[model samples]
Target: MVDKALNDLLTLWVTIEPIGTVVLFATLSAHLPQAQRRKVALKAVFYSTIILLGSIVVGQIILSAMQIRLISLQVAGGLILFLFALQMVFDFSHERPATPEKGHDISVFPLAVPSIAGAEAIMAVVLLTDNHVYSISSQFVTACVVVCIMSVTYGLMLLAEPILRIIGKNGAAILERVTGMILAALAVELIMEAIGVQRWIN
Candidate 1:
């Protein structure tokens, strides 16, 4: 049981990589003062924690109530992931906001919500909470894992200053594109598996 829980937690981390979120965060906080940047970074991680944990607890139910099939969700999530990844890989998108306005408030928009705890992240939470694969105890353990990941995310964001310098704007953009590609591939795999499972059940 311990081994399984650890494995699931690790898998969850890989699916929602902290480093990528850290990079995006560094990019977003580029213009703010060190103190202000730190504050924004903290808030961004806080928002991500709220969004992701919410997804873990009630996201699956919301999707069900919306009548969105898992397969469809996969395909749609794939597209979004692909776009985000494409930006990472190709280095096409502006790494930071152009003109670099001072004291801009961008913690919640692209940084925290979609970039960090985006659709793919929410999907991972829902999948992790799947009752068919994980027992009640497993679900509870996974929730604990989410809490730990949130801590990790907050810690990573706090180091946004050094992280940004280490991996410059261009480097960060490239990384995001690659992450997007991986997310796209995962999304495709998920849709395929859902189709196969539905077919078997039918």
Candidate 2:
């Protein structure tokens, strides 16, 4: 149980990547007032938490109803996450939108969606709670880990201002790029696992 909990926590942490989310949130909400930043941070975290929890609850049912296999979902999610990571790595505007129209209500856009509760993260939670592999109690524990991760994410976003003060724009940009690389690697690993590469090798 301890091992499973620790593994779930680490998986959730990597997939969610709260530090990367903090950098992006700080960059996007830098111009807003302190109160507004707080609101945006809270909303983003709130929406993301809801999304992850929903995925944990109903995502498997939806997939099963559609007769979709978990391996297929893993491959699809990897592809999507790879594309998103490319955007992060190559698109400067994606990191910090210059226009208000593009940046408006960023909490719901990139922040809550692909940034926090991303395809990879959603797929990960579903896979972790696989009915064949994990019991109800284990799945419930995984859900709790998801909430804990989101809580930490909220705390990081709230502290984004002070963290940004230390890192500065250039540092944030570098961090974003690094995060993209890490995500790309993880995506490839997910795809490999979905294809049973490790099992074949063994």
Best by TM-score: 2
lDDT of 2 by residue, 91-118 (tens): 6464343334644577886689777987
Candidate 2 residues lying further than 4 Å off, grouped into runs, are: 66-104, 166-202
TM of each candidate vs. truth:
0.65, 0.69
What ranges in model 1 sit over 4 Å off? 70-105, 164-202
| Candidate 1, lDDT over the whole model | 0.68
Alpha carbon deviation, residue 26, candidate 1 (Å): 1.4
Model 2 lDDT at residue 187: 77
With a 3 Å backbone cut-off (N, CA, C), the pairs that clash in candidate 1 are: 85-177, 85-180, 88-176, 88-177, 89-177
Cα lDDT for residue 19, model 1? 83
What lDDT score belongs to each candidate, Candidate 1 first?
A: 0.68, 0.81
Listed per candidate, the RMSD to the true structure in angstroms reads 5.6, 4.3
lDDT score, candidate 1, position 52: 79
Model 1: per-residue Cα lDDT over 1-202, one tens digit each: 6876787678778766788777666655554567877777777778878887787777778878998765675566555546655554565644455433465345775567555676666777788778778887878787788788878877887877886678775665555555556656655565556468647756
Q: Which pairs clash inside model 2? A: none
